[model samples]
Target: MKIGIIGATGNAGSAIYKVAQQRGLDVTAIVRNAAKAREVLGADANVIEKNAFALTAGDLTKFDYVVNAFATPTAYQHIDLAAKLVRELRENKTTKIIFIIGASSLLKPDGTKLLDSLLQDENAANWIATPIEQAKELTFLKLIDNVEWLAVSPQANFVPGPAAEYQLGVDHLLFNAAGHSIVSTGTMAEALVDQIENPTVPVRTRFTVGDK
Candidate 1:
């Protein structure tokens, strides 16, 4: 199947891109810089050098599945980009989208959103906007019914590492055996491609992945 990954040079995107490559899938890196994508994903990497916001419906609908791993320093763009993509793919029948969102929208053991606890942290002001907007992105997506979409959220302590065993949860936050809410980029990639190849999570629903 053909797959296109936006922001394929970033940590999560790069990891997923590499996994897709190893699986011998027809995967292309939708990146801003062909040079940077080459540096991160080697010279032979399939690339479409363009700004994510500049992508057109024709560009996206060519793939069977498009994974939005887009990240930016301007937090609100998360929601904006999600809207843009949905608009472009409205009523589309050929391509589906998988959004990689933050874990802030997941529920804690106490039944409150993890975003609530994050808002209480003193340092939250600096980086909290990203999660907040991502939560809004999910919220906005839930209101749409005409598109084929699925969102995947990583654990609270998402980090860079090789692949490991993982567990999946819906809505609720999950902790591994050592009691850490963590998921490696490799593990997340595995989960993503697995879903792409054999999707079980229904369209329009969101799921979380945690290291096991």
Candidate 2:
């Protein structure tokens, strides 16, 4: 399958790029700068570096699937960018879009979200804003329907590490006895590839990575 990972040079994007290649899929990575894209991601994978804001309907049509794991520098602006992507898909009739949302959107057992928990302290508000930005983009996507969208939440404590054992859950969360939710980038990448081939259509729900 031919796939395009929008924001394919970032940490999460780079992880996906490597996994896709190992799986033998035809992949194209769209990044913001060509030179950096080649340097950071290497020159083996197909890559196109262009300002995301400058992407058009034609740009979106170049792939069979597009996973938007990119995040804007700010939250409010991120929503506008996400809207553009949704609009771009509609205009081009491109049907599949997988958005890399934040873990803040997921609900804790107490009914509060990860974002709400983090916002309780002054020292953490600024830190939490990053995830809140993801929430904003997801809120805007709620109004879109032209594409099949999948939103994924990394474990509550997303960190850099090798792929570990995990589970998958939809619309809620998966937590271990230690009350921590975590999954390696490698595990998340595996679940994503599953969705790419046998996409859960009309499944605009959010999924999480946990101990499988």
Candidate 3:
């Protein structure tokens, strides 16, 4: 299957790209900077060097799966890009889009959205917009029934590391053996590719992953 990963130079995207390569899947890094992507993913990495917003339906429809791992400090771009991708694939069933949105939308044990607490943090003013917009992305996806989409959310603390044992949950926050709501990039990558390869999680739904 052909897969294209936007933001392949980023942490989450790089991990996913590496895993896809290890599995010998036909994968391409859809990146804005060919030099940077080659530096991160290796010189021989299959690449589609272009701005994500510049990608048209024709570009995306070629891949069986396109992962929206795009991240930016602009914050609102999270929702903007999601909508753009959805728009490109509207009414098309052959191609699927997987989103690696953050954990801001997950529910706590008390049945409240994790975004609630994040909004209450005094120090969150700087980075709060990312989660807020990511939540909105999920909200937008939920309303679209025609597109084949899958949203995967990491734990409260998404860090960079290698893969490990992981547990999956739907919509609720998950804690690891150490009582920490954390997931490594490797684990997230494995879990995500697993779902993509196996097709267990239903389309148009979001699932959470945490280190086990």
lDDT of 2 by residue, 1-212 (tens): 88888888877787888788888998888988777778877867688877787888788877878888786677666677778777787744555778888788888888777788778867985576677788776677777766666678787777656666667776566776667787667777777877787765345667777744
Tell me which of candidates 1 and 2 scores higher on lDDT. Answer: 1
lDDT of 3 at 194: 89
Ranking by lDDT: 1, 3, 2
Q: Cα lDDT for residue 173, model 2?
A: 64
List ranges where model 1 is wrong by over 4 Å: none
Residue 105 lDDT in candidate 3: 96
Write the residue-wise lDDT of candidate 3 on 127-191 in tens digits: 89999999988898899999999999999999999999999999999998889999999999999
Per-candidate TM-scores read: 0.99, 0.91, 0.98
Clashing pairs in 1: none
lDDT over C-alpha atoms for residue 77 of model 1: 92
Supply the global lDDT for candidate 1. Answer: 0.94
Which stretch of 10 consecutive residues in model 2 shows the poorest summed lDDT?
198-207
How would you encode candidate 1's per-residue C-alpha lDDT over 1-212 as one tens digit per residue?
99999999999999999999999999999998999999999999999999999999999999999999989659999988999999999999789999998999999999999999999999998889998999998999999898999999999988999999989999999999999999999999999999999988989999999998
Task: Give the per-residue Cα lDDT of candidate 2 at 41.
Answer: 71
Candidates sorted on TM-score, descending: 1, 3, 2
